[model samples]
Target: MPELTLEATSAIAVAFAAVMTVGFAARQQRWGPGLMVVGILGFLGIISFGIVTRL
Candidate 1:
């Protein structure tokens, strides 16, 4: 199995951070579940990307 590259990890981390931040902000502003869904999907997508790329 190949080692996980820093570039790929960083991308996933950044995406996760962005999604969570937006989610928290939305929750604070009472934006409801729609925005929360966006954040959740974004987070899951990033996780999936990491798993698919990682060995």
Candidate 2:
């Protein structure tokens, strides 16, 4: 197995977060899910930023 770099890991995390955000946004009937999506994106952003800074 090959070792994955920080960029690859960050890309996967962002993709997963984007999918969840879309799924939650599609419901359009609850504020909780929407807020969850925002939180997920925010967390991903912070993580990516940290990863980039370390590089």
Candidate 3:
């Protein structure tokens, strides 16, 4: 597996963090399930990216 460039990893990490923040905020505000889905997708995307990169 090739190492991820620092910039690419950071960008993805930042996006993941931002999505998590939105998820928590939405939960606090009693937003519907859609926001939750977005959050989950964001998290899973990061995980998938990591796995694919490592393979």
Per-residue lDDT tens digits for candidate 2, residues 1-55, read: 2445778867767776776677577657666577667757767776676677767
Q: Specify the highest-lDDT model's number.
A: 3
Range of the 10 consecutive residues with the lowest summed lDDT in candidate 2: 1-10
lDDT value, candidate 1, whole model? 0.68
Model 1 Cα displacement at 47 (Å)?
Answer: 10
TM-score of candidate 2 on Cα atoms, chains taken together = 0.46
Model 2 gets an lDDT of 0.68
Better of 2 and 3 by TM-score: 3
Candidate 1 lDDT tens digits, 1-55: 3544779767766776676677677675766455667767777776676687664
Sort by TM-score, best first: what order? 3, 1, 2
Write down the TM-score for model 1: 0.47
lDDT of 2 at 13: 72
How do the residues 1-50 of candidate 3 rate in per-residue lDDT, one tens digit apiece? 66668798778778767776776777756564456677678778767877
Q: Give the range where candidate 3 is weakest over 10 consecutive residues by summed lDDT.
A: 28-37
Better of 2 and 3 by lDDT: 3
